[model samples]
Target: MSRRRQLHMFDNTTESELHEQTFTDAVPTSQRYLHRRGETYYFKRKIPTDVPHAFGSKGETHWQSLKTNSLQEALRRLPAEIEAFDSKVRKARESRRQGKVPVASRPRTEGTTKYLQEAHIPSIIERFEYSLLQTDMEERRVMEDDAELDIRLADFEQGLKLKKRAAAREEFSHVEDVAQVLLEDERLIAPPGSAARTLLLRELMRADIQTLQKQCDALRGNLFALPPTVPVAPRDLPTMQTAFEAWRQSQDKDRTIDAYGRYVRQFESENRELPMASISLETANKFRDYLHGCDLDRESIINCVGGLATLWDFYERKSNRITSNPFREVQYDGLPRRESSVDRRRFEVSELAILFNSPVYLGQHKLKGQVKESAYWAPLLGPFVGARIEEIAQLRIADILRINGVWCIRIENLEHDQRTKNMGSHRLVPMHKEVIQCGFLSYVAKQKLAGQTHVFPSQRNTNKYRLWSNALTKWFGSYMNRIGLEDPRLVYHSFRFTFKRQCTVCGISDEVRDALTGHWLSRNSSNVYTSDADRQYPFPAVARGIKKLRYDELDLRHLHVADPFDQVDRAWKY
Candidate 1:
């Protein structure tokens, strides 16, 4: 028999009409899984027959109000509801296959004493405070349109003042879901109808009333606000390692993250991984003592303590449980703060003369390292342009280009492998005339012709820290030691001090000096307001200051080469 003849009731309907009717009866694309009842939209889905119903025996359908009347808003909130429904179905099927009842079906007396702890009270209060804040913000958004809200809020406050249980119960009803979420987050089974659950609900209601009272007082034009009480850490407090991972994720620089991670690892190893809450001020002081006993320098100990402080601060902000950092203002007995100039002193004119006249600078040294180009140029660039060792080490050939008729080196984090110290560090520094005279431009041209991406192509960053200057920094330190310039303070960074001192001696303005050194300008400074174009093509004052930067005592005439590529290729050979 033909299919049309075999069909029962719609046999008389044409095939085209049947197809059209099928399409018409289907839900609209925009309203999928949505049902409109009165003015609000509800998320509705039919439970599959294969999956046992978890939402009681009411029907084989799941329904949840989207709590919005507007179609677009309902649609926006539909995805989460759909996922919740699917999760319920999956849980029901799993429970059925296991021949076990769901947790909701368990007796109320089954909950343990763990759920009844007084420590959870503060967490409950914190949750209520957050919810109250959200409600206040939402009410403020609609207060202008609804003129009666303030009066109603005042009335609610009065009801609470009268110790009305019904009003508190009504407020508690709205936060039942929030309470449930808190229980799940704490991994506590506060069985329904249990004393533990009752206590939680009672505290939640009390917290709501307290928050509402504060809101009512604010509406009365009281500007003074008390600081919130710090919440107690829960039984399952996060460890220092946990806090360190979280803080590490928040950091943007790889070098900083690696350095901080090392400090945290050392702390955990020494202290045996104590919980964050357990580490008191005394503990911090002891850790400081431990670091001192490790024979670490005063500066290194301070840095380690600072790293701990940063991690503690991050956890406090994130969890809102810890109020004060134990590591803050830690004292180091018998250790005074080192003087800046004394810590990393600028090189003397005689030291500069010795350094420039060294075998490495004169191309007569037999140093066995691949970072020859970096070792050669980094020190020169540091003293002349005030570029950091890492900055000069990571420079690309493309970074060397003339802008607005001035030779400029662009320090930026635009490339995939490049990184600046910070946002202010990304700038254009005019090439010092002395740097150009020292075969810098000629070397850059040679590298470009050789199709090299980085200026120091031989210097490969193989370390986990991804520091391009790691090899060169080590080599420079050793070289300094070998050349009889072995003062502990006189390292690579001393070149920056040397540069700044020269600028000061030559009467360079603070603005121009900071600009050349990539230092952040003050917010009130006119340089902060300068346009991007002006920044890229620095003003004549900057170029003039670059030109004025002169090392008159140290003669680099013999060090200057007509062609740097024609010199010995020992540094280039890996």
Candidate 2:
């Protein structure tokens, strides 16, 4: 154990009283160099000294000196000096071994705990393993029924392998005998008949494979792992989907299921060949093509795949799952998310004729499949009642009320109000007397009435109401083509538009029309200030307008106008 060496790194300056040192005044101990640097610390420069000496054993060239300092200063410096000296010695010895300096002697403190931990990590691991093996051998010296030693041995191994992030799995191999027994017990704990057993085994196998894979991935991910001269991209990019599930969780659960379905369906149908983890940009483009060609409207595309783009964001934040989200870079574009024109406000003359006729209020034909017979009545009531699908779906037996002995359905704040879209929408609408007994209500008394709630609740699956609008439109289109009455540019929503137009032509006030349509006047101004009573401020005036449209254009005779639908049936009954 030869005496350890030291280097004195100091700068020469014109101090009032100072001496020179053999080596230079080093920036040692505290990780920092003593300099008048920017906004950091107050200066702590040591007073200079003229102490020159070369202290090294034969054939070795090393700088060495001794200095007197306050006890606190020496204590602060000693640790740094020791470390720096060791580093320099190792470097110099390595250089010498390359035929440059001199062969090195090992330091006296080399056998100490700190030195051994830092310098010989492998040897420390090997020794711990040997101790465990010897302990096992000692246990073997006792009888098989030595329970205390067995517990001690199990504890020892458990202590050795406490962390999931493994350290020195090589030494772990020595604990194989106990590990095997513990593993066997774990295997038995998973009942053989249960799916949990297969799941547990698969998980265990996956954990091992993934843990090493993660380590390698992390090694590649260290920013400074590559040389400073190399070019690198910051692993995160715009296209990465991260934490979207957390976002999607905040949405309504039905919407959540719809969103998940959109993605699942896309993967199932188009990207079937691509793994979710390995889905590439080309596949996303293919998906985009598949979506565009589905004949879905622009709004549907936005609804379905907006959820998916959000899904990609969640994918981006994942580390072990997906290092890079391929969907992040994928560009998804579709048609504008607005109805082109609610302006073509015409009622298909034929459909309107049926309401004007109301001839025995006949149910035309039975609807097949997921639809009901009354489903044919939706288009029958749409414009005539000014009912939105959500309002119609939530209709119950109780919400309908008679005012002044006039039979009218009163739509109130229906149950499941959370399902409605727009504000001021849950308000009541006074149904025409004919609409109440339209057979739609008679069907409702069967759904277990609690209050004057949703009127046609059987149709209210939140989705089922609008399902028939398209089929009805197509059927009407073909019927009109056969009948030689040119098809009109109208949709289900056109019902409300026609009702509003007739109200306007009949000179009903804007407020009454809005009230009838369950709309407020000034969304910002009208909602807060105007009450429903105020909305229907002049209903008598509005009823006059309703009468004019009932009589003038529908071209019903005086008796027919009085009870339009019954006219044709009454004539024959007469």
Candidate 3:
């Protein structure tokens, strides 16, 4: 028996497992519902038992050949095929319930009329023109005479005249088959004899007549005869998937692309994947409202809208056809006003005291996979240096160095796959005296002596994004939750806010604080256009600001270790 026949013979359990393996293991997740037979792929799905008769299928499953062997091409064509299948199933179910024929039908709405007139008819005319061009090219390749072309043009004219006459007499029998083929090709299921079908048939007949007239005029030696003027072709409005792929290619950072791509995918899921041109201002507003209704925070909604706006702007600039971005100037009510300072919730001094007195800082906690030296030192460094978690987690032993006779930790994207948030993030931050006194230097020395490349070599950077801090961030969240610090805004990032608050309290200059934290200088600030040498804060001056960062209420005397190598060595063995 054939492999396809054998597949049908398998029991439910085995069939499901095989289906999972075939789709999941052999292809990417986005390409599900695809089944490969020999070399060509087919879109296959099991027909619901209730709707099997509606689909007119004898077997338990139904499938259609994708008609392409190239995986990339198949992927490109898959979305439309999937949409058509879904539309078919939906219409079939509706018809079965109504006890009507299994044909697609919809109440003629204003939006449907607008789409048919502005998008669908123009698309049909363009396709007809392309097919005509293809036939002409084939005839020219065979050296066919103009007499044959003239005869074909005459036949088209006669067909158009007959169609017009039949339509005038309310007899659309001649055009029904042609209209049905066009409707099916566009995946619009107008019932066999419904008024909607009749309207579509009459419109197609009109387009056909106009096109035939143009052809006859061209054949009569008017080589510059203008084709029928329909609305702009729907082909000009690219699919959402196509636009995203183009936009994604223009991006520089993988993380930015991935972050923004997520919002795009979410938008596509919430709103149907529509062509860029079809996304009107109303559509944009509805999408924003939908996101708001989903209980997403205002900031998250802003990001989603902002990301799509950026993408829309990119596509507008690239295409030069999209007149305006729908997502532009979309408003969200009840959004909080922006704050100048870091907006994250800061850890209270008492909370800091509790965290420092925890078992990990007291050296009583057991070392596991994620709860390693990084976890212990990273939190300690956060308040002192104010570096991002990923920046600190990805640190190397070589990053610890003496600059201008002051011990400084360099945060840079120089080696070992280190990545800073941006160019401004690359800077020299003097090690705080508190960090030094807490045996941070001793830990670095031990890592160097042990010939380890990364300070937190035990923390795995195994995520797809290769972020060393992913696992550590999750563990920190759980740790905070366990320690009774269960506020939504109180996160690992809160350390950065606390550090900034301390900088203000310590009377640190804006330039020094910005330099240390790797924040961008304000465009209107005097230091924005300063020379590189003038902008670079001396390590001693930075160290002074760093030393001023003191928590009078929080003491960490117990965390100071005279020798950490032995303790770290013992922990490493675990």
Candidate 4:
């Protein structure tokens, strides 16, 4: 045969024969999803029409470079890639159907009657709302299914003999499958669905309930396809401060709101009266640079940016009020994190002696004008028990109780008037004998006799969020300055470190020390298990540790008064 005639015959080969030749040359026949191009594997699939519109693709086929030269690794990743593509297609189709968008063009116009008429399309916002409602309904159905499963499981656990345990196990596996399919928590592995795994799944679901709801909304809006700069506006939009108020209201405590106020204020001050919708990457960068210009450290800048991002994110994900977050993923470009420059010093033994010997301890100088029992005991207790000034200041009379035959103060968040840092901060701090010897219990009895709930009644609640934290912290700082230990960071918090050091000097175990100091227990299964349990710290161990505490070098013997009732010996006067 002539050479030209042979080439023409090869080009005219049947499609099946051509595919077979390509497969034999590049990929194994067993690997259905993997295709090889130039010795590298690629994920090749036909682009679904609906999915292509969502991604703005006009191509007939999509080829993703797996960036792997190994056939084995490509095979390993094939299933996940296919699953991801399927999910994308599904989401895109749902969005298009809900929005009634034409399959040909993906347009970006505000959802208005005029706009829709001109564009010949459904209102995108209206579509999103409808999609949200539909998703809400679907989520309710899934939640109902999960709830029914929970009820059945609870009945099984409670010894109700209606159904077999095997049925329950089967139901659990089914529910897990449904979750894996719907929720797409591919990272979770619940094989055969043991009780521990069930517990873990339940915890994960609880934590991600809001997030899952937000994802459903985002999918409905086709948010993944939207550009980062595109502003998403809901029908009813709130002002910047109004949005911030809504965000703050959703928080667990008012303290978080108060802490975030500084960032909000900074944004408003730097940028003149800008609306929440007006905030963009440019504005956010300006604010970051402003913070850096003010000589704020990297963490502070991170916190400011992070706080704003969190606020904006809450609105976007929770309320669906906005589309973009300017502060999200913002980087601190050239700013280096300065080592904490605060010159905090632990109270020296001599300094404690000097303070205790001064009128503040000796009852020679009486506390004046809203200065309460905290001034007296907090200073004295600082050297002994090593508690935060605010913790001591906010203590109720009931907190000081005898637990396990030892007098201790319970630092808890039970009272409406108190707040704790974390679970670790809520603990039983054993009251030193020196505290009782200095008429502390006598003062509590007096306050109780007067029908006072707070251990210190003289200090007013200047700020509602923090129970005299600002005022008392300032007072303590001034008192320290007066006594001549005037380091800026050596204010009230230094006592905590001093106490920690003293505990170390006394050879306290780390677990015991953490219990006393309100530090999280060892970062291990023990800590996680303990946190999950009803009781936080091991009480018996904590009690033993507390009993082991002794400030031997600390001598406040002169400060101790003989009579609890004597006017000359009244520590409350100071």
Q: Pick the candidate with the highest TM-score.
A: 3
Better candidate by TM-score, 3 or 4: 3
- lDDT (Cα, tens digit) per residue for candidate 2, span 4-32: 12211222222321223222344344422
- Candidate 3 lDDT, 57-153, residue by residue in tens: 5588878888976555666777888888788878766643332223212232211222232335556656655556446445534746977777877
Best by lDDT: 1
Candidate 3: residue 212 lDDT (0-100): 61
TM-score of each: 0.55, 0.37, 0.65, 0.53
| Candidate 1 lDDT, 1-574, residue by residue in tens | 3435422222233454334333334345434676667767788788776553266443678788999766556667888888887788787666443322222232222112234354455665775576566666566657664446668676868866764465544545555676787777656657777775766777777777777777776666553343375343343456666777778777767778867776766675555445565578988888887665544557777788988898888987887774678899698776656566665788998998888889888778865566768777888787887878888888998888775678778887778677877666777788887787788877887787687899988888778777788899889888899999999788888998889889989888887888777773432245657653344325677888887878788788886767643422432332
Q: Alpha-carbon error at 96 in model 4, in Å?
A: 50
Model 2, global lDDT: 0.42
Worst 10 residues of 4 by lDDT: 113-122
Greater-TM-score candidate between 2 and 4: 4
User: lDDT, candidate 1, residue 523?
Assistant: 26
List residue ranges in candidate 4 displaced over 4 A: 1-243, 251-255, 271-286, 320-328, 341-343, 462-466, 521-533, 563-574
lDDT of each: 0.70, 0.42, 0.69, 0.60
Q: In model 4, what lDDT does residue 173 have?
A: 39
Question: Which residue pairs come into collision in candidate 1?
Answer: none
For candidate 3, the per-residue lDDT at 352 reads: 90
The parts of candidate 2 lying over 4 Å away from their true place are 1-244, 247-345, 354-380, 403-408, 416-419, 433-491, 509-511, 525-551, 555-574
